[model samples]
Target: MTPPRVLAVAGSDSCAGAGLQADLKTLASLGCYGMTAVTAVTAQNTRGVSRVMPVPPDMVRAQMEAVLEDIGADAVKIGMLGSPENAEAVGEILGTLKGVPVVLDPVMAAQSGDGLNAEETPRALLAHVMPRVTVMTPNIPEAEKLTGLVVASLDGMEAAARRLVAMGCSNVLLKGGHFGGHDCPDLLFEGETGQLTRFAAPRIETRNDHGTGCTLASALAAYLARGLSLCEAARQAKTYTSGALQGAVSQQLGSGHGPLAHFHSGLL
Candidate 1:
């Protein structure tokens, strides 16, 4: 069987916790072929990101064109682009693709509360990339940043999702991880039907959740590439993410927030 191809346009993580590293791990574990176009190189670990160097926009576009023109992709997952130029470069490529699922994780900041994007990057993404996105996964803070609203409760999440849909998003997955509770509920708002679906799971108590957002978005892309519906793909991705968090509960990798156990399913 041919493995579904997924192209990840993101940054490089030195700790192998997030960005393209996590995307590759998640795609591979889900039996998909993973390709990467690095937008930035980060000097980071489990603790924090100290430095970031954005790849040239032309170089980033070239890498993506080389991959898409040759191997091609069944789906695409986009994370931190580092700069507004990189975002427009990626957006140009996205505009050319047809019938491919694109999962956009609006990664404004890292789990450690460190900024990962330029100040103008969000505006660039909204103008160039958001219209082409198939499934947009944004946490509370990202939703707030993108829509300019206080996303502090479930009602806020729904409203934010609605605003995103109104802004031309095909679908919005407003993650509720920031809310304190025993259960983590993620809201999926479908643009076609203007309906909402809630996916709830027991919050796993673990510090090793560094790449969860990356993992979930990449997993969704993988499943979509394999022909799963949006809701089903989200459900599978959430389950995989939860298992990864649970699997890393007993292990200690770094002093700060560690990485998820992507191989928790023992697929390797």
Candidate 2:
């Protein structure tokens, strides 16, 4: 009867809206115990990221090893690896771990267009981390960056998802929130089944969607840690994200892209 343990490997958000803060909040809200291995420290708010300081590769590895060896997470969510070195370190740590589900939110660019990873980081992730990931969640632009395809339509998103599977990711979730559309559709491509599942939700008309991508990925990791299948995890995560978005309309925290109501579940 123990709660599932979910570890988040990402950056620290000073504004508490995105990155590790959002990951931890989402995990908790989805009924999982949360742990963290910070890869960077950022001075940021809803407006934009002002500065970032990457954590040493050795330190990143040390934190991952310590957490994996001790508390032993049931799942790990990776985000915002600030440098190629950090991504490499994370790849190495994931390689050594066994059985735990890993969800990689290929966070290349921030909500405000701030770049998080270096040019080499995406290649490193594909070469070293994709095979280890249980699922990869990428928005349209990130999908384009990862797969080198123009994701102008849903078909393009599916093609990019298939390419990601070819690149060794077992499952891919191509998010269509960035695309210009009325209905936000997300595609789930299963490598083993070769089936494409679609989840469409009405886009919440709110600017407080800053940490939504991070929240969805973390929620999926939490559910997977709790022994849910990938499809089930995605369903639950989508619902949670929609609810968070809907709840954020009345509570705007920052001047720019505000944060979702992570404490809407009352765990915070």
Candidate 3:
């Protein structure tokens, strides 16, 4: 029997913490068949990112087309595009394919505070990638970068989310992970229905929250690949991520912001 397929277009993490590694782990844990089009290769560990060598834009396009044209994807999760060209190329490819679930993570930095995208990459993504994004999950800083707004409070997050939806994303999940709060308030805004839902999970006190952004977005894509609605997918994805963070409390992985145990179910 053929399983639902989720294609992850992202960079490769040498620590196997985030990027392609996190994406694949999340997809598999959620019971979806996973495929990939690696955009960049990073030489680093859980502590911080040291070097990032991007795959050529043409090669990135080739990898995407090869998997998409043949194996086909039920959903796609786009993480860090190494450059403006890479972002535009991916956007161009997805624009041609209609009715596929695409979750754009809009990654900007590593958990240990290393830059991911170039200065112009966000603008390029806004121009090219936003229109194709079914659901965009951006943390506070990313939202601020994308919208040019000061995202410091829940009200600010809501306003930023509305702005993101107006930019062409079908839905926006504004993650509140950058700040310290008892409840991590995530706001979801639906473009079609204008319905908003809030997912507030208690902040798991652990530095092992690395790769969570990638993990959450990939989980959303996986659930969508399995034929779940956007709301349900978001719901499940949040639960999955929360569980990983909770499990990380007991984990002994890396020195700095360690990776979450995506396979917590199996680990237990």
Candidate 4:
């Protein structure tokens, strides 16, 4: 039998350390079949991003439609669109597939402090894409940018999550890893039911967290494809990322910002 299908609409990472590579790795580890509709192509590595070339809006549309129309998707994970026009294109397509669970990672910057999107990308996501998201995963900085709140603490994180929920997004997972601490806590604010939950994991001290946001969102989507609840998916994804980081703490992957150990099954 074919496995649960998880489609990743994101960018391509040349180093196989982030973007759709991370998504695919997480998906397979979670027993989900992965597909992709690349929105941008990044000249990046464990070090940092050198250049970005966004796929045209029309091409992005074609890629998404091609997968969605054929194999379809049990869940969708969206990452860096890189441009406002591509964001709108995806928004329209996902709007039509409302029943499919969509995990949105508003990737604004790389872990290496490289800027990832155009200035207008976030606005387009907020207006066109966010409302359709089943789970919105944003790091502290992303939450602040998307919600216009000063998220310097956990209380600020809660406030920012609520703000994003109020902005028409379905659920918000405000990630706290960016906040300076050894302990990381992610707050989940569900919009329709007003349910709130927190998933916390101690920070793994390693620069090898390049695609964490992308990995978390993709892992959540993969778990959702397996019929897990939103909270359960988030919790499992958090646990998975924590383990991946812990496993990579000693391994020398790269010079600058490396990648998490996505495969615990020892497959690759």
Of the candidates shown, which would achieve the greatest TM-score relative to the real structure? 1
**What C-alpha lDDT values do all the predictions have?**
0.94, 0.90, 0.90, 0.90
Output the worst ten-in-a-row residue range by lDDT, candidate 2. Answer: 259-268
Per-model TM against the reference: 0.98, 0.97, 0.97, 0.97
- Residue-level lDDT of model 1, residues 73-101, one tens digit each, is 99999999999999999999999999999
| Candidate 4 structure, TM-score to reference | 0.97
Give one digit per residue, the lDDT tens place, for model 4 in 1-268.
8899999999999988889999999998888899999999999888899999999999999999998999999999999999999999999999889578999999999888898899999999998999888989999888888877888888898899899888888899888987777789899999889888988888788878878888889989988998999999899899988888887777787798888889864532
Q: For residues 198-225, could you state the per-residue lDDT of candidate 3 as single tens digits?
A: 8888889998988999999998998889
Give the CA lDDT, 0 to 100, for residue 158 in model 2: 92
**Which portions of model 4 show Cα errors greater than 4 Å?**
266-268
Alpha carbon lDDT at 228, candidate 1? 95
Weakest lDDT window of 10 consecutive positions for candidate 4: 259-268
Which scores higher on lDDT, 1 or 4? 1
Candidate 2, residue 206: how far the Cα is off, in Å: 0.4
Point out the worst 10-residue segment of candidate 3 by lDDT.
Answer: 259-268
